[model samples]
Target: MIGFFVITLGPMLYSLYLSFTDFSMLAAPEWVGFDNYIKLFTNDPKYLDAVRVTLVYVLVSVPLQLAFALAVAMVLNRGLRGLSLYRSVYYLPSLIGASVAVAVLWRQMFGSNGLINQILDWFGIEGMSWIGNPETALGTLVILNVWTFGSPMVIFLAALRQVPQYLYEAAAVDGISRWGSFRHITLPMLSPIVLFNLILQMIGAFQAFTPAFVVSGGTGGPVNSTLFYTLYLYQRGFTGFQMGYASAMAWILFVVIALVTAVNFWFSKYWVHYDD
Candidate 1:
């Protein structure tokens, strides 16, 4: 606990204070109360763009990821042969999804001369560079984010396993179809896990950096379509040399994530069912 406070809490509080200053990692931090935060809302359109991009990413990616993960989990739960091998294969993407190599590979894969375009060419379809097009650049990042469904799938599998078989047995006796049983019994029982995965993925989506960074070449290029919140924060802090401004952005993101998570927890009372 003491170590956590010192290592984690200490930097957090210090950074919070820094958010109100005008530090450029040069000579000294000048005290400028709320200037950075005020500028973010009033003067900076790019910051607002980042906010919009981040919200779209979180809203779009998390649901698709959860849905895909749940579907995969349900299929795998049906006692497939060679389960361990298949499980590892599915889980591999999530493990390396954020790696620099994978991001670079995705960038290449979505380029005009890459695998996707090559496949399209085989079908006599003209291919455009996905990562180079403003419309499709962000979409590629979303696809990359969705591809790592293994983490939530594993959690869903575990939650599904914990569900009492007696409920399903009883439901079957009462002529409940598979869909009906899943909708009523399985869904209600797995609600807690769903809530858990939602919160985690939402936070992660807001903090997504690698795909945009690598795919967009760290500039959120093609008209800033992929300017994720974290990437912008990083650019401001490290690239633009505005540590204090970046700190302000970080705190704002922290607040946004906290409020979103709080809202989820609050709404969970309506949807999330606990067996207790």
Candidate 2:
């Protein structure tokens, strides 16, 4: 309890105080009374752009990632041979996918002379540099995010296994189609896990930083296409020495995530189900 208060609570409270003050790390923080947040919401175009980019990323990546995870989970639940081997193979990416070194490798793979474009060359088609173009830079990051679906995939696999086989047998006897069984039986049963993965991935997407930071070479570059919210906060606090403003941004992100999570929990009563 003492350690938690000193390590977590203390720094958090200090950071909150700093958010309302002017602190550049070199000098003592001078109280400014909401100036940082005012600048962030009223005067910062880059901050606004970061918010937009982060929102798009969370909304797009979370759903697509969950969909991919669920689809793959359904397949793995079908009792394929070498199930353990395949699960480990698929989970490998999620284990190291978020690392800075992996982000650098991803950048290289999408570069002009990289593997993807080289494959395109085989079909008599030219490919543009993925990370260089503003239009596609964020898209590349989204694909990277989706590629790390192994975590939720594992959760989905566990949830899939918990589903009683007798329910599926009943469906098979009823003349239910494969899609119908999934829609009526599998999905309703899996909705709780789906909501779990959705909430986890949504929070992760909003806090995502490394892929964009490393891929954009710490500049959020190519016209700021991949300027994620956390990356922007890092640029402000550590790089730009605007710690107070960055703290305000962090708190704002916290509030947004908290509200979204609350809304999800509130709405889950309508969809998410668990057996009594």
Candidate 3:
């Protein structure tokens, strides 16, 4: 209890108070009430841009990541030879995908005249700088997020294992087609796991900062195409020294995530299943 208060609750309360003030780290915080929030919504175009970019990143990446994870998990559940080795090899990306080193490598690979362009050259196809163009910069980040699907893949694999074999056998006996069996048996059984992975991946995608920061060189550049909400908050707080405004952004993000999570739970009854 003491640790929670000290580590979580205390800082949160302090930040909430700071959100209404004007703190620049070098000077004492001045009480400003709702000014920070009002500016954020009504006056700050860049903040609105960040919100749009972040929403695009989250909406596009999370569903693709979860779908890819489920597909890989289903493939691995087929009892392939050296399953453990394959699982470990596939899982490695999730462990390092968010690292600075990986982000640097990704930037290089997506840059003009880099490996991706070279590959395109081999096929006599033109390739532009994926990480440079405003149109495609966010897409590269989405692919990166999708590449880090190992964690949810492992979870889906476990859930697939727990599904009753007899249900599949019954479907087979009833002459169900492969797709039908998957739809009626596999999907229903995996719905709960799907919901679980969706919530987690959605939240993580919203909080993502490293890839955009490193890929865009901390500017969220190319006309702010990759300006994630967190990245903008960091710029305000740490770079621009607008800590109070940053605090307001942080609280807004917290509320948005909470609302999104609540909506997911509220809608889960329509599809998510349980043993009960």
The model with the greatest lDDT is: 3
| Candidates sorted by lDDT, best first | 3, 1, 2
lDDT of 3 by residue, 1-276 (tens): 999999999999999999999999999999999999999999999999999999999999999999999999999999999999989988999999999999999999999978999999999999999999999999999999999999999999999999999999998999999899889989999999999999999999999999999999999998999999999999999999999999999999999999999999999999988888
Model 3 clash tally, residue pairs: 0
Which clashing pairs does model 2 show?
A: none
| Reference-based lDDT, each prediction | 0.93, 0.92, 0.96
TM per model?
0.98, 0.98, 0.99
Estimate the TM-score for candidate 2: 0.98
Question: For model 2, what is the alpha-carbon lDDT of residue 134?
Answer: 94
Q: TM-score: which candidate is best?
A: 3
Tens digits of per-residue lDDT for model 1, 1-276: 999999999999999989998889985888999999899999999998998888998999899999999999999999999987888899999999988999999988999889999999999999999999989998888899899999999999989999989999999999999999999998999999999999999988889898899899899988989999999999999988899999999999999999999999999999999888
Pairs of colliding residues, candidate 3: none
Instruction: Provide the global lDDT of candidate 3 against the true structure.
Output: 0.96
Candidate 2 lDDT: 0.92
Question: Which of the two candidates, 1 or 2, achieves a greater TM-score against the reference?
Answer: 2
Worst 10 residues of 3 by lDDT: 83-92
